[model samples]
Structures are given as structure tokens and as C-alpha cells.
Target: MQITIVSGKGGTGKTSLAVSLAMTLENVQLLDADVDEPNCSLFLDLDTKLVAEAKIPIPEINYDLCTLCGACSSNCEYNALMKVPDQILVFEKMCHGCGLCSKICPENAITEVPRTIGYLYEGENKEFLFNFGSLIVGEELSTPVISQLKQLISKDKPIIVIDSPPGSSCPMVETVIDSDYVILVSEPTPFGLSDMKMVVKTLRILEKKFGVVINKDGVGNEELELFCQKEEIPVLLKIPFDLEIAKNYSKGVPFLNVLPEMDSKLKKMIVDIGEALE
Candidate 1:
């Protein structure tokens, strides 16, 4: 089963829960889909060997072969191409690789060229396969790179743990789609509750199964619990507000390493999720 651990916003212990669950599960594959800023590997401490580099093949126009007919520029929905009086300019960042400009180019000047967008890495930790992705900085769109990461999931006996992007936007939607279950992590704050509500609405519309995890549980987040009860969403687990956990995380350490108790709790959570699925 592919399980995604996501949060409505950043700094809410989303990656913490994901890494803890990854360390607890036996023979599982971890895929961190927050390509824009993947911090999961920082906590793993394993020397990462390259899995694959993700790239988007964008359309490039050969200026010499172009007649400045403005056809390619007009056909480009992404506005990557612009026609000048004597030449055509192609902005690499604005291109989406749709190939429509190439197909519409009467001068046959457009062709595909590959540029490195991000990379995928895999390494072993204890027994689990730790995998994650890194998006090239300044790359605006992440869905393509995320799709490439999803393709890496093994078909045989694989329990995939996905660390999804924050918020209920396009990137988060793509990351969590078609998952067997989703684990939502949040803190005990008004902001946390509000974002969680947005995420819950999105999940309900998509008709996916998910539960809530209250991180920093003792800091007055009863509203979240009440909201969950009112909405009939499952409250899976509660993690206390521990400064030690935060400090260890800052030093690139998983809570499971310093606090072995996390392993047991995560294992129990996984077991419960498994039973619910069954």
C-alpha cells in the first residue's frame, strides 16, 4: 500500500512523522515527494547513492532555421517562446514541454532538449529502502518531477511511504493521489486547525481515507480534536510537545534514533493503519 504523510503547512512535524514511520516499517520504501525542499534524507544519515536524475525535455527553437513567422510563439500556451522582429527568443523557464509549439512550427525549428530539473536518491537504512527526490532550485513546476518519483515504486511486496508537500495545492494533490491512506500531521494551533480543515475537505472531495496526527499535542490543540470528532475523521496518534525532539531534528537526527520509544509508537500506528485497511 502507498501511504502519504502530509501536513497543511510547513514546520508542523510532517517530515518527522514520515521519517519515523519509515524507520519503523520493515522492508518499506520511502519516497519524499516534497521536491522543492526535501529534508527527509537529512535525518536518515545514510550515504545516498544516486537512483536517477529527473529532467523535463523542453522544446527549443533553432533560431537559424526560424523565419520569425510568429507561429511557434502564438502556439505556445506557456509563453516560453516570443517572436522578435528578426529572431525568436525562447525562455527555458516558461516552457512546459507540451511540444505544441514544435508541432505548429512550419519552419520545423523546434526540437526537444533535456535539462536537469531534479534527482532521485536511494540508500539502505537497517533494512528499509530510503528513497527521496530533490527539485532543482528555481524550477517552478514540480508535478513532472513528482510523477517521475512515483514511477520508481517497486511492484512486488512494496510498502511505499510518501512525504507529501504542504497545503492542499496542485503539488500536494499530485503527491497524494491514489494512495491507500493519508496521515495528516498538525500542531495545536488555530492555523493548524484551519489548514487541516482545508486538507480534510480536499480529501473528502477526492474520496480518500485519511487520519489526523496531532504533533506537539499538549499545547492547547483541543480544537483540532473537536473538529475531527465533529467531522468524523479518525484521530490516529498524538505526539507531545518535546523540546528534545525539536533539537534532535535540528541536528539532522531522527527522533527514533535518540528516542527509541518512537519506533514502538510508529509501529503501532502502522499496524493500526494496516488493520483498518484490511
Candidate 2:
């Protein structure tokens, strides 16, 4: 089974929980799909290697065969192409690599070329297989890189844990959409509740099965729990606001290492998720 761990916003211990949960499970494949800021590797000691480069096809204008016909520019949804009187300008960063510009070009002056947008890394130890993607600086879109990362998922493992990007945007959606289950990690604060609501709405729209894990549970008001109760959303586990957990996290340590007691809880959460899936 594939399980994606995500949050409504950053700094909510999403990656930390994902890594800990992966370590708790057996025969797992862990994938960090947060291309823009993949930090899951920081918590694990794996000899990772650059396995593949994530690329997207961008339209390349061939001036030799070209008439500066406005067809390519007009059809571009991202405004990556612009037609000037003398020539056509291609803005590489803005392109979504949809290949529409090339297809619409009447003169066949546009050709698609692969542009490296990110890198994919793979690492394995006796515990589990690991993969993560890192977006190149100045890249506007992350969904393509995430798409390439998901392609590396080896179904050979019995369990797959995906560390997804925060928020309800395209990148996060792309990461969790195909998962068998999603674990939404949120704090109990007001901002956390607000953002989690947005993610809840998105998951409901996508018809995805998900549960909540309230991190830093002691600080926030009871409203978050009340909301979850009213919505009938399952509360899987709660990690209390503790100083040792914070300190370990700062030192790039998984909470499971210092708080061995929580390992059983994490395992039970997975078992609960399996029961729910059935």
C-alpha cells in the first residue's frame, strides 16, 4: 500500500512525521515528492546517488524555418511564447512543457527540447529504499519534477511512504492523488486549522481517503479537534508539544530515534489505515 504524508502548510513537522513513519514500517519505499524543498534525506543516513535528471520539454523556436506567425504565441496557455515583429521570444522558465506551442505552430518552426528542471536521487539501506527529487533553482513549476519522481516508485516493496509538499496546490496534489491513503499532519493552531481545512476540501473533491495527525497538539485550542469531530474525520495520532522532540528535530534527528516509545503508535496508525482501506 502507498501512503502519502502531507500538510496544509510548511513548518508543521510533515517531513519529520513522514520519515519517522517510514522507519517504523517494514519493507518500505520512501519517496520525498517535495521537489522544491526535499528535506527527508536530512533525517536518514543513506548513501544517496543521483539516479536520474527530471526534465520537461520546452518549445525551441527555429528562426531559420520560421515565419513569426502568431500561432505559437497565441496558443500558449502559460505565455511562454511571445511574438515580436522581428522574431519570437521563448521564455524558458514560464513554460509548462505542454508542447502546445510546437503543435500549433503553422510553419513547423517550433521544436521541443528537453530542459533539466530537477534531479532524482536514490538510496537504500537494509531498512528501506529511498528516492527524492530536488527542483533546480529558478524553476517556476514543480509538478513535472514530482511527476518524474513518482515514476520511480518501485512497487516491489510492501509499503510505500511519500513525503509530499505542503499546501493544497498542484505539487501536493500531484504527490498524493495516486496514494492508497494520505496522512494529513497539522498543528492545533488557528492557522494550521485554516490550512488543514483547505486540504480537507481538496481531498474530499479528489475522493481520497485520509486521516489527521495533529502534531504539537497541546499548544492550540480545542477548536481543531472539535472541527475534526464535527466533520467525522479520523484522528490517527497526536504528538504532544515537547522540548526533546524539538531539540532532536533541530539536530536533524528523527523523533523515533529519541522517542522509541512512539514507534508502536506509528505502527498502529498504519494498521488502522489498512483497516480503513479495507
- Give TM per candidate: 0.91, 0.98
Question: On residues 46-109, what C-alpha lDDT tens digit does candidate 1 reach at each position?
Answer: 8778789888878777878988899988878889888889878889888777788888888898
TM-score of candidate 2 against the unseen true structure = 0.98
The collision pairs in model 1 are none
lDDT of 2 by residue, 8-59 (tens): 9789988999999999988899999999999999999888999999999998
Give the worst 10-residue stretch by lDDT in candidate 2: 101-110
- Model 2 CA lDDT for position 98: 96
Candidate 2 backbone collisions, by pair: none
Candidate 1 Cα RMSD after full superposition onto the native fold (Å):
2.0
Report the poorest 10 consecutive residues by lDDT, candidate 1. Answer: 123-132
